[model samples]
Target: MNNGYFGFCGTPTRANSQNLAEKLSCLHLDAFARKRAEKFGLDIVTTSWEDNARSKNSCWGPCITDMSLGVKEDKPHPRDFLMSMIRKPNYRDETCDTPIEKFCVTVGNEKKNSSLKRITLKEFLQDIALYTDNNVKPMWRDRDSQIVTSVQA
Candidate 1:
């Protein structure tokens, strides 16, 4: 998600729905998140970063049509399985940013059976960027981003 500011924050979790939505919305506004979301079958278009005040100017693109995994029969990835299953499947539109004071109270209520946890959009995008740039290998293993932590002695 990057948020165009902080570096890697962390993966999304189930607790921070509003923050996650904000991050997603910000990322959607950028070129990088749009490209990655399309490739991964994520439903990014429905989200609106702006609340009612800015809804008229918000952008709406194609909705995510494919939520299936890359593997045949939509097999779940190892990491995906380890994360929250019920909450993991849930996704938020980036454009849904209504201030609590002005908007309805029930808008961002927490869910009981979500499969994924809420993570900062920056972390989410970082994860996707890492995979896209390095063929899914962690940054530590990437030739360009790898750091020399070992001592010769």
Candidate 2:
């Protein structure tokens, strides 16, 4: 196809993925996907971990590439987004920020025969969250845990 790069999401969980093991996994897998895509003429874009605060160049590389490759006019460029960021104060999330509205969410799993369900975000949270004194909190969070990365061909 075009002279573009291939991408893979959900690594580091984006480390622009979530941790060290994930970051490395993303980098290596990005390399592998790139190679595979070359054979079929495809370009995939993924957010990867950079040395600077694990961010710095995260979007810069992909943004430039996207613009150069003729992204749709409706999509905002990174530079335009930055300009909007400076003037973005009116938007608000009533569900998460104010709790005034309960947004509907789709919940499901990858298991076969499992049916998806649409429920209020608050209701979904009640299943996985703990409530005390009217305050809602998550059941648990990752805390400096180590993870292993491996690949097989």
Give the per-residue lDDT of model 2 (tens digit) for 1-153.
223543334323333534333333344345565565446543333321212112332433331211111212233333111100111011110111223124556666534577887775545555554223345665333331222111111
Per-model RMSD to reference: 20.8, 18.8
Which candidate number has the best TM-score?
A: 2
Please state the error at residue 52 of candidate 1 in Å.
27
Give the TM-score of each candidate.
0.19, 0.23
Candidate models: Cα lDDT each = 0.32, 0.34
Error of 2 at 125 (Å): 1.4
Candidate 1 per-residue C-alpha lDDT over 32-144 given as tens digits, one digit per residue, 9 for 90 to 100: 64555456545233211222222333444333222221212233323221111111112332333332223211211233453445543334334544324344633222232
The true-versus-predicted C-alpha distance at residue 93 of model 2, in Å, is: 12
Using lDDT, give the best candidate's number: 2
Report lDDT (Cα) of residue 142, candidate 1: 24
